[model samples]
Target: MQVKHGFIGFGNLAKAVYQGLKEEEEIEFAYFARSRKEADIPYYGRMEDLTAFADVIWLMVKPQDLSAVLEQLKTCDRAGKTIVSPAAGRNIAFIERYLGKEQLVVRIMPNLAMAYRKSVTAFATNQPENENATEIFGLLGKLGKAVQLEENGFDLFTAVFGSGPAFILSFIQIFKEKMQEFNLPGPLLDELLLELTQGTTLYFAQNQKKHSIEELIRNITSKGGTTQAGLDYFRTHEIGKHFEGILDAARKRSEEMSKNGD
Candidate 1:
């Protein structure tokens, strides 16, 4: 049977998810948003119509917009439908308050890498054994690595995986800024950084099973070498701890949002 999937809001993240999953033969996609977007999928003018047409409904609106959207959803006949939400800081319990406890609600934290089908996604659901929820989890695996986690773990997961790409890119930006002395074109510098990151990722992938991350770093560092000097400075200044603070701040914000529900 073909599965109909509907998006409540067709923003960037929604677009990324559609791009990731549209090739699947069993799924049919459509959306209802404030404005129609350019896409090959069907666009519904009314939320009620979209809700009625879809078996799986993706609440792809912003976290702040979720409440208003759910209010509209409350009027829809949602029996037997699965609700999948990726809005950061919003938990299953928050959604359950609107949709009721019996609804199969899947909450996920997937990074922007979803567009490339390489997202590290965290999954949690109100109904773990529901066939629809399980299938959605399996579908997440096809997009990238997917792990079933506790709802409480989402805050940390959002900090690390959900917002991790921008954090990683910021680190790369530091390198780019440092290399500006060479006066290379910005695009060329970006390409070089991309190659460097790709090579590093390949090296890690090749040896990760045999070596710990520390071991990998040790293999690159030599006695009195440039890498060692940098390592010494990094340790001395507690750079790792500083980075952890960034993640902590993000997780704290998620917790606050969960509490405030705003």
Candidate 2:
């Protein structure tokens, strides 16, 4: 039998998964949204209706929004049901505190790549040794990589991998602008950048060879080459330091939000 899935908030990530599983042969869902339009699937206006239909619920609301949703959820029956939270900064303990001790909760940090059904999601359940953890992991495995992590490790994952795509895109945008600044023709520049990134990514995926990524960079860089010239320019401008500062700020904000943080 297909498991009944439910969502508390119907945001982008929720919609991504909904679209991914909506036509699946073994999955079905109904969701809860503030307004009917907010949900991509059939939705109920009342939490009670959603609660009764769901065997596993995905909580997608903001950290601040969690409290009110918890209050409302407390009025419904949650025993034996699994509650999965994909919100950043919130943890299993917080869910247990707000929902109840009996709630079977899991926390995940799935990147936006899930929109394309390709995500590297980090998952952590409240109890590391729980028997049901395997079942939970298997279910999520269909969506993408579902690596089980210690709950404490979630924060670190959030700071790094969860926010990694944005960081990479920021760098890519700078590279794009640099191409324009050099008066490279637009179409040719676009093609070069696209192949530069896509081919490099494909090469790494195919090889998975013995060397570390830094070692791979060393292999490509020759003495006084164009790549070395660009590397020198970034080094001179303290690009590494700038990246550290950017990630540090992201990590700090995540910490703040986890503790009643916005």
Candidate 3:
């Protein structure tokens, strides 16, 4: 039998999930949103209609918009439907507060890389053994690295997995900005940066099994070389600790959202 997946909000994350799974066999898609989006799938204006149509419902609204969406969801006949949420900082317990403990709530932390099936996702569910929840977990395996984790781990997971891509890109931007002395066009500079990142990633992929990350760095750093000079400054300025603060800030915000229900 085909599984019907309904999105409660057709935002970027919802679209990424759709793009990731649309070509899969025996899966149907639909969505309910306050405003109609550009997607080609069937649109349900009413939450009741969407709730009735889907076997699995993805709650795709923002964390701040989650409460209002849940208020509408509570009025719908949601029996036999699995609820999946990717909203950062929100936990299964916060969802259960509206739909109750019996409803299977799957919480996931995934980045926009979901569209490319390369996302590193963190998964947790209110019901671990339930076949439906397990099925959802298996479905996540198709998207990327899906690790089952406790709810308490979600804040760090969100900071690292969900927000990590942007942080990496921000660092890349620093390199791009510094390379303006080359007088290269912006697009060419971006392309060069892409090659650099891809090449570095490929090198890591090829040698990661044999070498630790520190060993990998040491391999690139010759004695008193340019790379060594940069590394010296990086350590002296505690740049790594400053970068860690970015992750810490994201995690703290997630915890605050959980406590404040936002």
Candidate 4:
């Protein structure tokens, strides 16, 4: 039997997940939009109508946009329907209060890397709700890694992994530009950087040899070597401390939003 799903917002993340699920023959999906024919998926003119066909409904709107959506949804009974939200700040209780006690709700935070099936997604839910738990896990399992975490941890995870990919990609691009500054050929630079980053990750995964990341760095930075010189430069420039502050600020903002973004 095909597992069908629907999305409330036809945004980039929604479209990406739709594409990923479409690749698998057993999952059928669609979305709701203002216009009926804007996207390839079947669109519903009204919010209540989407629940009719899909067992799972993904709420993919902005945090601020959620209130109006909820206002429309308030008139509908979502019993037996599983709703998954990817909004970074909203908690499951907030959703349940608005939707109803009988509704099955799960909150998730997924990064843009989900486009490539590399997302590290965190799901927070009342696990005692067996049906919703299974539905959420089964649906998200297709896109990438799904971790069940306490609600308190979701906000922090979003700051690190959900928003971390963009930060990492920006750093990668900065290095790529630095390679160009050295007059390296563009395609060769791209190829080298791609392999360089992937190889770094591969080293961790392939080596069953467990070592702390700091230990691994120390192992590479033997006394008076090139790695040591680079490490010294980074430390001297205070880049490591600056990054710690950056991540902390991001985490704080996520926490604040969760508290007030209703």
Candidate 5:
């Protein structure tokens, strides 16, 4: 049987997911949003119509918009449907309050890498054993590395994986800024940075099983070398602790959102 997938909001994350999954033969995609978007899939003018047509409903709206969307969703006849939400800060219990305890609600934290099918996704659900929910969990695996986690673990997951890309790119930006001293064109600098990152990733992929990350760094560093000088400065200034503070701030915001529900 074909699985009908409906999205409540067709924003960037929703578009990334659709792009990642649209090639699957068994999934039929459609969406409803305030404004119609350019896409090959069907667009429903009404939320009720979307709910009725789909077997799985994706609540793809922002965290702030989730409550209003749920208020409308509660009015729809959602029996036998699965609710999948990727909105950060919102938990399964928050969803259950409106949809009731029996609804199969899947909460996920997937980065924007879903567009490239390389997302590291975190999954949690109210009904772990339900056949449809299990299938949804399996589907997440197709998109990327999906790990089932406790709801309480979601904040940290959001900090590391959900918001990780931006943090990583920020580090790359620092490199780019440093390279400006060479007077290279901005676009050329960006291309060089991309290649550097790709090469580093390839190296890690090749040797990760045999070497710990610390071991990999040690292999690159030599006695009284440039890498060692950088490492010494990094450690001496507690830069790693400062980076952890960034993640902690993001996690704290997620916790606050859970409490505020908006």
Candidate 6:
């Protein structure tokens, strides 16, 4: 059976989701937005019309705009439709407030890596045993590592997974900036950094099951080597603590948004 998936807001996240799932033979895509997007999918100007057509409806708007969209959604005939949301800070309970208790709402926290089918996603639902809800969770597993987690854990998951890609890239940016001393072209620097990250990831993937992360680091660190010297400076300056602070700050903001957005 071909499942019709409709997006309420066709922004970057919506685009990523569509791009990630577009190749599925059993899934079709469409969008309902204020203005038509550049995408070639079917477009509906009315929320009711889109809801009627879609078996799965993605609440793809930003958190601040989510209320307005849900207000409109509440008026639609949502029978048998699975509501999926990736909005940060908003929980399934928040969506159920407008849609009602019996509605199957799946709350997800995923990054733009969805476009590459490599997002580490979190999934929680109002209806756990519902077959349709389980199907949604299965689809998430196809996209990446999808874990069924409690709602309370979402804030930390958002900080670590939803916001993780950018943080990792920012760390890479530090390397790129330091490599300015090499006088190489900017694109070449990025290419070299990409190789470094990919090689590091491959190394981890190869030995991660049997070895601890600290052991992996120790394997690369020789006694008084360059990596150890850098590691010493990193520890002495408390860089790890500072990086952890970034995650904590993001989690705090997510918690704040969860409460105040109501």
Q: Write the per-residue lDDT of candidate 1 for residues 25-140, one digit (tens) a residue.
A: 99999999989989889999999999999999999999999999999999999999999999998999889999999999999999878888999999999888889999999999
lDDT of each: 0.95, 0.81, 0.93, 0.80, 0.95, 0.94
Clashes per prediction? 0, 1, 0, 0, 0, 0
For residues 1-262, write the lDDT of model 3, one tens digit per residue: 8999999999999999999898998899999998899999999999999999999999999999999999999999998899999988788888999999999999999988889898999999888889999998888888888999998999999989899999999999999999999999999999999999999999999999999999999999999999999999999999999999999999999899888876
TM-score of 4: 0.90
Query: In model 4, what lDDT does residue 110 have?
Result: 85
Q: Clashing residue pairs in candidate 3, if any? A: none
Superposed model 3: Cα runs more than 4 Å off: none
Q: What RMSD, rounded to one decimal, does every model reach?
A: 0.8, 2.4, 0.8, 2.2, 0.9, 0.9
TM of each candidate vs. truth: 0.98, 0.89, 0.98, 0.90, 0.98, 0.98
lDDT of 2 by residue, 36-135 (tens): 7655467888999999999888887877898789888988998788888888898888888878766778888887777666777888887556655566
After superposition, candidate 6 runs with Cα above 4 Å error: none
**Candidate 1 vs. truth: CA RMSD?**
0.8
CA error at residue 261 for candidate 6, angstroms: 1.0
